[model samples]
Structures are given as structure tokens and as C-alpha cells.
Target: MAKTNYQELVFDITRLIPPGRVCSYGAIADYLALGSARMVGWALRNSFIHDGIPAHRVVNSKGELSGRAHFNPPSLMQQLLEAEGVKVENDRVVNFKEVFWHPEELGW
Candidate 1:
């Protein structure tokens, strides 16, 4: 896929993440057959400005808000997640497995 297309795919998948649920960068990368979690992070870093893409819903595999630094306020990502009822403590989701949304399970 073209670079722009790949980025778009990342954003699209991110948007599908339900409120209060999170998906890992590796999951999104694997869903698109990209084989690189960093690619998903790169796309999110560049496309986060797009209004429809809920970039905050994407987290690191360990359920940590590793991408928090990329947000404008940095803490915005945690705030957003908390607003949706996803508890975050010490920069990590409190009940990660309970709230994790897997792309493969969605059959997308």
C-alpha cells in the first residue's frame, strides 16, 4: 500500500475503537498486515490532527499510555480515556485486559 493509504488505514482502524476500549499499536499493525507496531505509531503521530481519528484510543501493547507525549497537553490522552470510563493510573490502564479491544476479534 502507498504510504498515505497506510496512514489512512491506521486512522480508520483507530476510529473503530469504541469509547472506553483500547487497542494496541501492534494489533492495528497486524490487522493491516504491516508487521510493524512502529508504523501504526508513526501514522498516528502524523494524522492525529484529523478530527475523526480517535488517536487516544490506541495504546502500547502493555496498556500503557506510551503515546501520551504526542498529545498536545500530553495528559489529554489519559483524560480522554478516563472520560470514557477507562481508568488510568500511573500512565497505564488499570484494567487493561478487561478493556482491550482486539482488531482480529472484530473480524475486520
Candidate 2:
């Protein structure tokens, strides 16, 4: 077996997300048909810094922010997402249905 180039996978996932909307780690994994949320998390953590991936926009399937520690000052992701007009409360996005990015709509 070969190690996947998850860095590339992360960017590809990020590109699938449109501005003002977001996706979950599981969604990204499933979109790539990878079948593992942990793999998505690992990929995002490793690639976020240098790749300029919109890491902040990815949350857990329940819309809970789970990558706080990875952010500088530990709250940057929430702040950035909020700045983009995506509401965050208790470290989770409110009404994600209104802001969910569908890959099919974007032709991903």
C-alpha cells in the first residue's frame, strides 16, 4: 500500500467549498470517497499552514468546531469563520443548513 498525498487532498477539498459556506471533515472525506473522518482531520492539520487551505471552514458533521487547538491563539478558526459572516456559537456554526456547501452544486 502507498501513503496518500493528503496535502493535495486537503487543497482539493478546500477548493470544493464556496465562499460563505462550509463543509464537515466527514463530508470532505466522503467526497473524496476516503471513508474516514480521521484521515480528513490529519490532512487538514498537516496542510493548513502552508497550503492556505480554508481549514477554518471545516467542522465536524454536527457543525461543532473540533480543530481549535490547531489555530493560533486557539480561537482563530472561529473568529475567521465568523468574519466571513458564518455565525459561530459555542464554537459551532448556527444554522449550517443555510451555509452548507454542496459539492455537486459546485461541480466538484
lDDT of 2 by residue, 1-108 (tens): 133776586667676677678898887777777658888888788765575678888888888889888888778988889888999999889988889875556563
lDDT of 1: 0.90
Candidate 1, superposed: residue stretches over 4 Å from native:
1-4
The local distance difference test score of each candidate is: 0.90, 0.79
Task: Itemize residue pairs with steric clashes in candidate 2.
Answer: none
Using all chains and alpha carbons, the TM-scores for the candidates as numbered come to 0.92, 0.87
Query: How many residue pairs clash in each candidate at the backbone level?
Result: 0, 0
Task: Report lDDT (Cα) of residue 107, candidate 1.
Answer: 65
Per-residue C-alpha lDDT of model 1 across residues 25-69, encoded as one tens digit per residue: 999998888659999999899876678888899999999999999
| Deviation of model 1 at 63, angstroms | 0.5
Worst 10 residues of 2 by lDDT: 1-10
